[model samples]
Target: MRTLTGVDSACSVLAGGCDSPVRSGDSIGVPMFVQTRAEGAYAFDESGKRFVDYVMAYGPLLFGHTHPALVRGLDAVAADGLVWGSTHRHEVRLAERIRSHLPSMERIRFTTTGSEAVMSAVRSARAFTGRDLVLKFAGNYHGHFDVALLDAGASARTDGGSGSGIPESVKRDVAVARYNDLDSVDALLRGREARLAAILVEPVCGNMGWVAPVPGFLEGLRERCDHVGAVLVFDEVITWLRLGLHGAQGRIGVMPDLTTLGKVMGGGFPIAAFGGRAAIMAQLAPDGGVFTGGTHAGNPFCVAMAHRVLDVLEAHPEYYAQMEALARRLADGLRAILRKRGLPYAVVQDASVVDFKFRSGPPNRNYDDACNADRTAYAAYYNAMLERGILLPPSVNEVMFLSTAHTTEDVDETLTAAEASLEL
Candidate 1:
């Protein structure tokens, strides 16, 4: 194997030298190391430098990279075969397990990515209601799909066109509302009740950092959705098992009409699913009208990994508790360090997910507030931490995920590095 000097060699072949925009480190104007390997809570770059990883592959590695059980499960499945291209037992078993935990998902359909799961769920909502308009909260990203790319305008009232190549017709049918502000949603539903298909939101705001739902916010959305007959869709792709075994809806007690899940459910594999009431899910063909199909929708390897992920979650419920504790400890330590440095900072945390903003006041409640955070200060802190061999999410707007593999010692090491990093 040949090792490159920096991201330039990697970028020579790959666009931006990274698969994802966030991985590019262009936002922070820094060179992101090319990771060659990862195991447990650490990732190694091409230079063989090991950094304690807090990104955790952006929330898919609940058990951390190359977890022994996950690797073993995949090995077992590979021994049998990779893609059966037919309905498999593991897929059925995993669906049953998901439905058991998420009772709202009385029926489920598997997909290859979170984007597909969300797209299918939205399509189902439109079909079930026979409506065209779909409402999504600002900064609550569903995925990179056409419908999900629409943004709120400068007035924060008009629907801004797609940020990219999405069609105008598609953008016109979508509306953007302020997150955690139920009144904004109610206002949109009031005039468009007849045309409203669904209200899509991240139960806990993960994309714009970890801004959780305000008290009664989710319940309010549920009420509005029920009142307007719009399908309430919870995009729990990032929050699912990370919030609890039952997900944010289960922990918050505000169930949605349809739920999209990914990330931790895949156990580091590429798998995603969208499900809801039997009536709604039945709408998908070959049973009903809304078309959704993929060649590798429920491949055996991904299904086996998902099954093992669920099995681990069930057998050791203590993993959540331990990870949450570590998360809290890390948050508290960072908060103290920031205070000692006299820097204006606020740490927003939900269970094992944590994000810090370089602001003095209370944590951000919505997208606008998150945007107000000092990105320049965060970039300095990020580079400082990286120098100390502690890896954090490359962008300040992204959340740092803690996994079951992270130890108290890891948290302590992070804090020690943080204490020094804050000097920047």
Candidate 2:
């Protein structure tokens, strides 16, 4: 086995020392702690140090890392083949399972990543509506693709995208609005209704520190889309199964014309899906003008894992309640500890996700408020927690997650570590 320093040095050969921008350890100025293996809710470093994991692979490990049942299923699937290069029963069954939970997805299409799902959904919206404009919120991240990258959240440096190679025309066709502010949406959509193709949003904004929509916000969007005849797209890439069985739409009682799902459903595999009413989804290829295809769209291995994840959920619906309860315990414990220390931090939680801002006072209501969190202070806190054997999302913009594998004991351990980390 490679030593931690050896692994760290080996990473230099990779761009930014990481494949994904968000996974770079240096992005947060922390020395990379190399994980050799993970099980349940704990990760072991190269030196065999154990840490209580709260990141949960950015919310895809709903049941936890290397879940025994899921791994066993994957092993069985691998015996047949990874990818068959043709339609298979696994994808068909997975789609049926997803549609059972999200009835709004009357028609479905698969993709290898959430970014592709968003891209296809946007194209389908445009083709179906014969319009050019797409409206997205300031801190909502659909994906890293060109149209979705504008004014995206989840970046530690800037609210605006890097703006490197994105076209000027693409930027012009997109409009950014403030989340939880219906007025902002109305202001941008006032005269552009005729040109609007879709209003894409994350029903629960996870990229900007897990900001939940205010009561009327999503309903207002639904109404606005209805008035404008533009498709309402819910980017549930992060919230999907993690939020609840029905997801954010079910949890909030508001549905969208189109929905994009990823993360939890893939069970850590590279798979995502987009679907909505059949009328709109009909715009895609083989049935309509819009075109979308990928060889790895429904990889057999990924589909098998997805089925296993759903099997667990369907068998034990109580897992959702347990995860949420643990999340509440963790969030409330942190709040109490922060208060005792006279720290101004505020903890926000919904379902199984939790976020703590470095600022004192009210919870974040929008991207700007989330940005107001002190990064320097957060970095210190993050490093301290890591030293105390509690693994957290390295970025202030990212949220912590809970899994069925996590328990009351893990929550207590994390809280104790958190309180001790503050003392450092």
Candidate 3:
């Protein structure tokens, strides 16, 4: 494997030809020739090679690359100003737009990244309930906030330990539990019932692939939080803009007390947000003691782009239907190919996000189950796909994304590559 370093070579080196199977050079991990220009559904390499993008900037390209509408909207917003360090019109408009899309959000606050949004949300929970500790499920990521809670970072130490630089004390304060086990959460909530400030979770886990919460899992969390007076935080960083407008909250109908949103919020731009009841949100900044501010929190460009993106989602409720159909088509196609090849594999999917796990049983139920997936076979398949010009997230843990810009053509092409890649 070749190893290239530095920012300018970030893409070329890591994505060039020298990576390992863990740096495997095929399929989703395939290298682009380094292009100068391109837009929509496809990206160009430095050599001007056109490849359909399945990575989609880690699932933020809901409308695909450089949609003219988004470009024009951003251009208009930019003509007025770039960053005033002051709230622009898009702030109120975007908040209203988000709330309109997700009725559960009574108040919203912008942040520079998903991590900040999660941190602020956790802080709000503590201030609202006057508590300290937070609970999160193993394998369900909610950013890297000190106490915001999360599972293991990389694919080591199954019990989930202090991920390197994380302070020992920080890890100790943040509790972790098994995903899909309401009993585990209950035990923790009861053990620290009154002291529990919040319970953060990804309604549909993205890090270890799209593992949807077990039936009644989210509802049970909601009930437990209500019973203990702890805030229930839905970290929708990956599922936010991609899983319809209201996200998992809307798809599941179990609204969370607070939600941290990221992907697609800025339309490939750096943006994220958190929101909850106004009563709890009032505790931030000038309103309450909890402090949350960033010079670029609500940058005019990000807000403007996000506003336009939301408009696209809001205006076309059927977009998700299309996404679901295409996702299903792609997933079904791949699974059929595998079954025909007698490959021990299955597809775990929810809406546009999907993962190809080389497991024997039903789709994974938890991290333990996900661990059973054949990483070697997956690596081989990934290599095959990359060689076929389909790009995928490097790690098997990362799920596949289908953007709005992708059409039936893309899914069909992907499946054609999938069949060829899995040919062994």
Write model 3 residue lDDT over 1-424, tens digit each, in one string: 1122332375455554333232333333343233345588886655455667777776788888888767774566678877788876779888988898887789999998898999899889989999888888776656655554345432322343544455676665677877889988777666678888888888988866678888999999999889989899998988887877778899899989899998788888888999988889999989899999898899888887787787787788898888888889988888899889997667866787767787787776677877776777777776677667676766666788887788898889889998888778
Superposed on all Cα atoms, model 1 deviates from the true structure by an RMSD in Å of 2.9
Cα-lDDT of candidate 1: 0.84
Clashes of 2: 1
Off by over 4 Å in 2: 1-4, 156-163
**What is the C-alpha lDDT profile of model 2 across 216-306, one tens digit per residue?**
9999999988988999999999988887779999989999999999988878778899999999999998899899999888888888877
TM-score of each: 0.95, 0.95, 0.89
Lowest summed lDDT across 10 adjacent residues in model 1 is found at 152-161
Looking at model 2, the pairs that clash are 344-360
lDDT of 3 at 59: 71
Cα lDDT of all candidates, in order? Answer: 0.84, 0.86, 0.77
